[model samples]
Target: MSFHEGGPRAAQQKDTRSPGTGAGTVALFTLATIMCLLALAATYYFFVRTTTGQFIDESALVRADTIRGRAGRASTEFLDWLPVTSLVIAAVVVLFVTIVRRRWTAAGIAVAACMLANLATQLLKDWLPVRPYRGVQTLELNSLPSGHTTLAASAAAAVFLMVSPRWRPLAGFLGGTFAVASGVSTLINQWHRPADVIAAFLVVAAVMLPAGWLVLRTGKDWNAWDGDGGHWASSRFWVLLPGIAVVVSAAVAAYALRELILGMEVTDSTSSYFWAGAAMIVGTGHFAMVAAVWLFSWAARRRGPARR
Candidate 1:
C-alpha cells in the first residue's frame, strides 16, 4: 500500500485502541484505589489507637485555640458556607458539561460516585469505634473522615470528572485547593483532627478513582485531546503549582516537627502544632489531586500520528 493510504489506516487502528482500556491502566488505577484504602486505615490506626499519635493530634487541636479571635470566625463562616457552595458548584458544572457535551452517562457516573463518597464518609464516622483513650484528655466522640472535607472533595471530584482531559489539570488543582481550604478551615475551627481531614481525602480518592476508570471506559471518544500545553488549561502550570505547594507544605510541617522534638516550647500559644496539622492537610489534599491529574492524563487519548 502507498504511504498515504497506510497512514490513514494506521491512524484508524490507533484510534480504535481506547486510551484507558489497557491492562496497564487497570493495574495502575487498582493500585491507587488500594493505596487510598490502606492509607485511610493507617490514619485511623495511628491517630486513634496509638498514644503518641493521639497526643500529637489532640495537641494540634489544643493549639488551635490560641488563634480563635478572627481566623476562627472566618473559618467557621467558611465551613458554614461549604455545603451550599459545594452543591451549587457541583450541580452547575455537571449539568452544564452534560448538556454541552451530551455526556449523560459520564455525568451520571460521576454524580453517583460523588454521592457514594459522601455517604461512605458519614457511615465510616458512625461505624468506626470511638477514639480510644490513650492517656489523652480528649473527647470520646468519633470524628474520623470529616464530613465537611468529604463534601468538598467529592464535589470537586465530580467537577473534575465531568471536564474533558485538556481541562483536568486545571480543574484538579483548583478542586484540590478547595478541598485543602475546607480541611484547614475545619482545623482552624476546631472541628476535627488532622487525621480526620486526611481520611476524608482518602475516601474521596477511593470512590472517585473507580468512577473515573468507568468514565474513561465509557467515554473513550470524547476523552481524546491534545497532550499537555496544547491548551491553556492543559499547561504544566497546574501540576507544577500543586507540586510546589506540596513541597512547601512539607517543609513547614517538618520544621514544626523538628521544633517540637528539640524541646522547644511549643505549647505556650505557639500554634506550632496547628500550623503543622494545616500543612499536613494542604500537602495531602494537593498530592491526591496531583495524582488524579497524572492518572487521567495518562489514560486519556492524545490525538497524534500513529507510532510506526
Candidate 2:
C-alpha cells in the first residue's frame, strides 16, 4: 500500500507500522550507537593522542597550506559559510518536513539529533584534553571531531531522517555530497585535518542513529512504504553511489598513502598526501551516511507494518 503525501491525519497519531517488540530496531540502535562511540574513541586515540596519527594529519595540513593567493582565499571564504549555511539548510528542511508533512515526532527527533550531534562536537572539542605535543609543529589545541564538519553532517542527517523512505536514497546521496563537500572545504581551507573531520561525521552518526530509531518507533505509521518503485533517479542508485564512491576514493587514498609510506618523494607539500586527505574526508563522511541509511532501513524492516 502507498502512503499518500498528505497533511496530518487523525490516523497518524498511531503509526500504521507494526508495534512489534522492536527487538530488531533496539538491537540496530544499540549497534549503530556503539559504532558511533567506537568511531569517536578510535579517532581520538589514533589521531589525537598518538604520534603516527599526528604525522599524517599534520602532513595533510602542511599540504593544504600550499595553495596561495586567490584560490586559498576563495576556499576559506566558502568554508566560512558552512556552519551558518548548514544550520539554515537544516532548519529549512526540518521546518518543511514538520510543517508540510506535519510529522511532529519525526521532526522533533531529527532536530534533536542535529542539535545533539553539534553539541557533542563542542563538548569534545573543548572539554577533551588538548592534542599532546608529539614533537609535531601543528597546533596544540584540541580539534578532533571538527565542529564545522559536525554542523554540515548533522544537518544533512536531519534531512535524511525527515524524508520518507522512498526519498531516502536520493536524500542520502545529496546529503552525503553536501557533507563530504563541507569536510573537503575544511581541508582545503586548512580549517581541519582529515581525522578531525572524520571524527565529526562519526559523532553525528552516533547521535543520529539512535534518534532515527526513535523517529521510526514514534512515527511508525508514516514511515513504512511498499519500497521504491519510482523513477531511476529515486532508486538504489543513489543509495549505492556513496558506497561506490567511498570504495573508489578509499582505493585512491590508499595508493597515495602508500607513496608516503614507502618513503617516496612525499616530504613536500606537493605530495600525494593532499589527495589522500581529501579522499579520506570523502570516504569516511559518505560511509557514515550510508550506514545511517542502512540503520534506518533496518529499523523500519524490523518493525514491519501493522494491519490497518
Candidate 3:
C-alpha cells in the first residue's frame, strides 16, 4: 500500500487531524463555556449568600477588608501597567510568530481573538446590573466580569496560539495559571466578585478557541525549506530568547517582591505566595517548552523533515 493507505504514517496523520477536527474543536469550546458558566454561578452564589469575601478561613472577611483599604495605597498606575505589559507581551508573541513561522494569518487571528474577547467582556460588564454591597463603612458596585482576568486570559490564549504543537500544552497551562491568578487577585483585593472573574474567563475562552483553530487552518507553513542544500536560518531560535528573558526576569522580580519587599512569609501551606510561585513556574515551563520546540524545529529543518 501507498504511504497514505493504512500505513503507520497515515495513522499518525489521522491522529494529528483528530485534534483539528470540527467535532473536537466544538467539544473543547463547549467544555470551556460550561466550565465558565458553572464558575460564574458558584461565585455568584458564594458572594450573595456567604458573609465572607476572603479566600482564607477565619477572619477572612477582616483580611479582605484590610486588603481593600490597602489598595488605595497601591499605585493605580502600577496596577494598570499589568494589562499594558500583557498587551506588549502578546504583541511580541504575535510578531515573533509572524516573522519566524511566517504565519501572518495566525498572528491576525490572535489579535482579533483577543480584541473580540475584550469586547465581549466589556459588553457583559455593561449589561449586568451592578449589585451594591454595603460594607461596615463603605459601599461598592459589584460587576459581572473582571477586566484583569479577561486581559490575562486573552493574552495568554494569544501566546498559546503562536507556538508549535509540542509546546501548546505548556502554553495552555501557563495561560490557565495567569487567568486564575488574575481572578484570585481581584477577589483578594475585593475589587471584584468571583462571578465577575469567572465570566471574564468564559468570555476569553469562548473567543480564543475558535480563533486558534481558524488560524491553524488558514496559516501557511513557512517553515518548509527548499532542498537547495543551503542552510536557511530559522527565526524560531531567536524568538525564544526574548521569551526566556521575560519569564526569568518576571519570576525573579515576583519572588523578590513577595519575600523581601512585601515581607510575606512563604510556607508549605497554600497561600498567595504559593499561587504566585506556581504562576512563575508555569511561565518558566512555557518558555522552556517553546525554546525546545524552536530547537527541534531547527534540527528538523537541517534533517529535511517537516518543521514543527
The candidate that wins on TM-score is 1
Query: Ten residues in a row with the worst lDDT in model 1?
Result: 299-308
Candidate order (TM-score): 1, 2, 3
Task: Please give the RMSD to the true structure for each candidate, in Å.
Answer: 2.9, 5.2, 9.8
Ranking by lDDT: 1, 2, 3
List pairs with backbone clashes in candidate 2.
15-221, 16-221, 18-306
Q: Tell me the tens digit of each residue's lDDT in model 2 across 108-158.
A: 888888888888889888888988988777889888888888888888889
TM-score of 1: 0.93
**TM-score for every candidate vs. truth?**
0.93, 0.87, 0.58
* lDDT of each residue in 1-308, candidate 3, tens digit only: 77668875555334423233345445654565566456556655554434332222112222344444455335343345769878887888779878977877778888888989988878876765444452322234546567887888789888877765445545555565566656656656656544466556667766775675565446324322223233222334334554664477477536633543464563323244323433433343344334333322332232222345
Alpha-carbon local distance difference test for all models? 0.88, 0.77, 0.54
Pairs with backbone N, CA or C atoms under 3 Å apart (clashes), candidate 1? none
Q: Looking at candidate 1, what is the lDDT of residue 3?
A: 87
User: Residue 153's C-alpha lDDT in candidate 3?
Assistant: 76
Report the candidate with higher TM-score, 1 versus 3. 1
Model 3 residue runs over 4 Å out of place are: 1-7, 10-19, 22-25, 38-62, 65-78, 132-140, 219-306
Better structure of 2 and 3 per lDDT: 2
lDDT computed for candidate 2: 0.77
